[model samples]
Target: MQYLNGKFQIGYSIRKNDEEFVYNNGFLYSYSDDPEGINEWHNYKGKKVSSLVDPYEIFFYEPADVVPGKVKITASPFWTVTKRGDIHFMMNNVEGSDKAKNVHSYKKASDSEFTHTTEFPGGELRSVGNDLYLISLENDRPVIRKAEGGTNDWTVM
Candidate 1:
């Protein structure tokens, strides 16, 4: 099955032992799946490949909208496609927490560069150059820096 969300498109196939799902964001294609379900899922379809499978039945949510920069699909918690379809934000839940989370939040910066953010407490995530940065308030003061490379790698002037 194939689904288009702005600049990103998703293709998926379910098989008995090896299922594959791929997401295309203009510049690159990313994929995931389980190998065990490939054959079983493939066999049912036989030679018919063009037939539309009911995505609504398999997914948790219905597609609310599809446009150049956005697509909303019904999933466990709902999902939004952004950046001409380069980004996909899926609603999720944190383990042992009552609040819902947004997983799979990715944005394409270019044909070769993409970024994603995971929500945390009292902070915002962003990308600067090739690094991921976080800005948060510490002791009522704004603390800004690269999140992964090293401490003090970034400073507020």
Candidate 2:
């Protein structure tokens, strides 16, 4: 650590084999020897293998916006994808409150926005197989409930 001008600066040193190191504008960067993996693939006999299709052709990507404009996701969402391709999400909107509400919602794979369901007390959601479960606090004790299908309606388990 060093005090330069009026600010304190920290420094670090790292050593790794087959890594190129660079320091510029108070920033450090390290890169592998084969950064782009031009010779990556290998056969069973440790010989370079050739494929009919290139890596980019084998794995194509096209980015798209998934979130809806009207929806505001304020908290960490507990989400799961069902066997039928429906997406279920449970989130608590209350920030730093003891009486937070856990709101449940879902959206079909073809739908653009999610449909809100009845809200329940604060809890964490867990999905097992095609079943959904919730673990909440009741009188400071752990209480468990299973969701009825993909809706918020729950049955105490």
Candidate 3:
């Protein structure tokens, strides 16, 4: 039951009665101390699998490290630049899907990472004096929304 940084080290044995198997990179690993010294490897669905040469070589990944409910961006993002020269965009996810199509901002043009600004409807994003505003069409009419401070709260104007 020894782990380092959420990864189970090799040769560590779990309790025999522990029905929960270990998983790493979507592969399940099971420990055994039988006379033949063969470890069982299975998929997440409990089906037997042999994709790995040795199960002990695999490190069990912690479930908390796995990102839940992550979805892919389905369309192009509306990009805009702030007055302070920062970049921002409103990304679009799949239509009619429960996933987020949120707005994100970058501190600089060369930055590889983006900060999540707020969950916004499909719209054209504009930066007004370093503030984010969305111009979206709602009910066949154009609506303007402004972000409140640095939070996800927005106000329709």
Which is the leading candidate under TM-score? 2
For candidate 2, the lDDT comes to 0.42
lDDT of 3: 0.42
lDDT of 1 by residue, 1-157 (tens): 2233212233322221112111211111222122322222211112222223543222222112112223222233222233233333333322212233333334443333234333433234444334445566779998765532211134443
What candidate 2 gets wrong by more than 4 Å, as runs, is: 1-75, 95-100, 108-113
- In every candidate, how many clashes are there? 23, 0, 0
Q: For each candidate, what TM-score against the reference?
A: 0.26, 0.44, 0.40
- Candidate 3 regions exceeding 4 Å error are 1-74, 95-100, 103-113, 148-151
Return whichever of 1 and 3 wins on TM-score.
Answer: 3
User: Where does candidate 2 have its weakest 10-residue lDDT segment?
Assistant: 23-32
Candidate 3 per-residue lDDT, tens place, 85-149, comes to 44443444322224333444333434433455444565776666667787888899999988632
Q: What's the CA error at residue 83 for candidate 3, in Å?
A: 1.4
Q: Choose the strongest candidate by lDDT.
A: 2
Tens digit of per-residue lDDT, candidate 2, span 1-157 = 2222222222222222222212211111111123343434432122333541333212111111122222222444455555544456555542221332445566554555456644566477666656678888888889999864456667888
Cα error, residue 116 of model 2, in Å, equals 0.7
Model 1 gets an lDDT of: 0.31
lDDT of each: 0.31, 0.42, 0.42
Instruction: Order the candidates by lDDT, highest first.
Output: 2, 3, 1
